[model samples]
Target: MKKIEAYIRHEAFEPIRLELLELGFPSLTISEVKGSGRQKGITERYRGAELTNWLRPKVKLECVVASGDVQTVVDAILKHARTGSIGDGKVFVLPVEEAYRIRTGESGEETLQAHPGVAQAAS
Candidate 1:
C-alpha cells in the first residue's frame, strides 16, 4: 500500500476530484492549506494598503491506495492539476505500513476497498 499526498492549486480541485471518481477512486481526503514554494506569494491591495501574503492558498488531497494503483492515481492528479505554470503543486507517494477499518476491524489491502458491495475498479 502507499499513501499519495498531492498539493494542488485550489482551482484544480473539482476537476481532479471528478476525474478520480471516474477512475473508481471515490475515497479521499481534502483540506485547504497555505504554503510558499517557487511562486512565493502574492501582493494585493486591500483598503489601499499593499499587503504581501507570504502563504498562498492550496488544496491538499490525500488518499491511500493499493501499491499497483499508485501511478494511475498520480497520473489522474497530474492530468487535471497541471496548468503549465509555477505553483502547480507537487505529489508525493510514501510507503504505508498498515491500515485498519475501524468499523470491521479489517486490515491491509482489504481495508482500502470500497465498502462491502460497492463496485471498485480492479487494482
Candidate 2:
C-alpha cells in the first residue's frame, strides 16, 4: 500500500475529486491548508495598505491506495490539478506500513476498498 498526498489549488479540488471518484478512488481526505513554494506568496492592497501573505491557501488531498494503483492515482491528480503555472502544488507518494478499518477490524488492502453500501450512499 502507499499513501498519496497532493497539495493543490483550491479551485482544482472539485475536478480532481470527481476524477478520483470516477477512477474508483472514492475514499480520500481533504484539508484546507496554507503553504509556500517556488511561487512564493501574494501581495495585495487592503485598505490602501500593501499586504503580503507568505503562505498561500491550498487544499491538501490525501488517500491510501494499493501499490499497483499508485501511478494511476497520481496521474489523475496531475491531469486535474495542473494549471500550467507555478504553485500548481506537489504530490508525494509514500510507503504505508499497514492500514486497518476501525469499524470492521479489517486490515491490509481490504480496508482500502470503499464499502459497497457506503459508496452507493455517497452517490
Candidate 3:
C-alpha cells in the first residue's frame, strides 16, 4: 500500500476534494497546517506596516491508497490543486508498511480501502 500526503492551499481544498470524489476516489483526511516551502515565507502589509508571514495556512491531505492507485490519485490532487502560482504546495508518496482498521479489524489493503479517499478506485 502507499500513503499520499499533499500540502495544498487552503482555498483549494474543496475543489480538490470534490475532484477526487468525482474521480471515484472519495475518501481523504484533511488537516489545517502551517508550512513554508522554497519561498520560505511571504511579505504582507498590514495598516502600512510590512510583516513576514513565516508559516502560511495550508490544508494537508492524507490518503492511504493501494500501490496501483498511487499515480492516479496523485495526478488527481495535482490537477485539481494547481493554481499556476507560488505556494501551490507539494505531494508525497510513501510506502505504508501496514494498515489495520480499528473498528472492523480489517488489515492491509482492506484497511486502506476503507479510508474515505478510495471509495471506488479506478478498477
Q: Could you say which candidate leads in lDDT?
A: 2
Model 3, 1-123: lDDT tens digits are 898999998877887787777766676898999987775877989999999988988899998889999999988888878988888999999999998888989898887554454545632
TM-scores, all candidates, are 0.91, 0.92, 0.83
lDDT-superior candidate, 1 or 2: 2
Can you write out model 2's per-residue Cα lDDT over 1-123, one digit (the tens) per residue? 999999999999998888777778898899999988898868999999999898999999999999999999999999989989999999999999999899989999999997666545555
Candidate 3 overall Cα lDDT vs. reference? 0.84
Q: Candidate 1, residues 1-123: lDDT per residue as tens digits?
A: 999999999888998888777777888999999999999868999999999999989999999999999999999999999999999999999999999999889999998887543434422
Q: Which sections of candidate 2 miss by over 4 Å?
A: 117-123
Q: How displaced is residue 32 in candidate 3, in Å?
A: 0.7
Flag regions of model 3 displaced more than 4 Å: 114-123
Q: Judging by lDDT, tell me the better candidate of 1 and 3.
A: 1
Candidate 2 local accuracy as lDDT? 0.91
How many residue-pair clashes does candidate 1 contain?
0
What local lDDT does model 2 show for residue 4? 98
